[model samples]
Target chain A: MSKQELTILGRAADDACCQGLASAPLDEQRAADLAKIFKALGDPVRLRLMSMIASREGGEVCVCELTPAFDLSQPTISHHLKLLRQAGLIDCERRGTWVYYWVLPGVLDRLAGFLAVPHSAKEPV
Target chain B: MSKQELTILGRAADDACCQGLASAPLDEQRAADLAKIFKALGDPVRLRLMSMIASREGGEVCVCELTPAFDLSQPTISHHLKLLRQAGLIDCERRGTWVYYWVLPGVLDRLAGFLAVPHSAKEPV
Candidate 1:
């Protein structure tokens, strides 16, 4: 995404103001932005990779540590990780021989908050 | 999905207890289930369609009303709606000649809540 696009997402997270999809539809740009993230998460392997990274100790994990946990090759795991990074769901930095990854704070929160039903809609119908 | 698969999704949502993908790697069954939902949300047209249905006035919108909002053909819109229904994110009822769509309720909530970061990981690093 461009800086401007990132800013829109930043604003949504900072304000915590995105309404539930049930309450109102997303604007075109927002829907497009969100769909990309959801698309990145659509794969079983990628989703598992994200979970491992997000829930890891200290909220981050190294590529080396993540590789052995799966039946897939290191390159395959790295490919999944690369997709997550491109979606802005996670970020990584090289630390000596291994690259460590962590969830980019608030992206998931924005999504979770976006889907949250308003108080009026929370009760059973 | 088969009744067995529906049972699994029902179990996950009813329990309100899917661990966030970032928390731990998703087991094969859970990953496959969630990936289908995420994949349904992956498309730009489908995402907008879902948001429109989810956030529509009176909690529903008819196929007639929805088609005009897009540049696509009615069949195209219907195809997207079908995908949403197949994903279990929304359902519809036919009243007269038109079919009205609405979010299924809790399905988005389950997906949203599933992405939520645990309290332990909430603080900024």
Candidate 2:
């Protein structure tokens, strides 16, 4: 079975389809794929979740630790984690009874690359 | 009216609510506000739109120029623009018949700040 991989912005770095959109129009498939990744980052719950997990001590955190951090229920937090995971922003491993999540650095790095301002480019008024 | 001023990641830098979420759980209001911003970036069309306008020549581009970049109709593009504007990612000005849009550099800068990885932090396995 194909693991429902979450892009986690790590995938986004690899998904260079975004680079073309500015220079030209996006085809349907590309738009859909691109949209899926952005959509993953669309929720505040998920955004905070990603922030928490990404910046957690040891550079990785467990599901048990993440669950109580929010007012949300376990399933809800799990749902958000699922989205982040699918987006490829994070990766998880089963260690004993607990599952740990860690930031996929490469994806975040790509997102930063996309947002980097060209220093030589004239500033917009 | 307290402007529904979209956050545009520009606000994210100032909001500082995100900073706490990593170490602590987010309060209700902050989560909602933060979520709204992420929701705006959630759409594929909007993401592409921001990329187009942000990276355009002269650091600004008009709605007319943005319209043809996607397969969607003008109204759809307009809707996406509204979301971007509300999110504070892009600013729009009425110039005669054509409305020009420019990247809100501050917001994007904040987003980059939030995503910046602490170099001293160990990489996640």
Instruction: Highest TM-score: give the candidate number.
Output: 1
In order, candidate lDDTs are: 0.73, 0.65
Per-residue alpha-carbon lDDT of model 2 for A68-116, expressed as tens digits? 8777899999888887777777778888898988877566655544454
On lDDT, the candidate that comes out on top is 1
TM-score of every candidate's chain A: 0.79, 0.77
- Is model 2 an incorrect, acceptable, medium or high docking prediction? acceptable
Candidate 2 ranges with C-alpha deviation above 4 Å? A1-3, A6-11, A15-34, A118-125, B1-9, B15-31, B118-125
lDDT for residue B16 in candidate 1, whole number 0-100: 33
**Number of residue pairs clashing in candidate 1, backbone atoms closer than 3 angstroms, sequence gap of 3 or more or interchain:** 4
Error of 1 at B66 (Å): 1.3
Please give the interface root mean square deviation for model 1, in Å: 1.3
* TM-score attained by chain A of model 2: 0.77
- Please give, for residues B42-80, the per-residue lDDT of candidate 2 as tens digits: 777877777777667677788888888778899999888
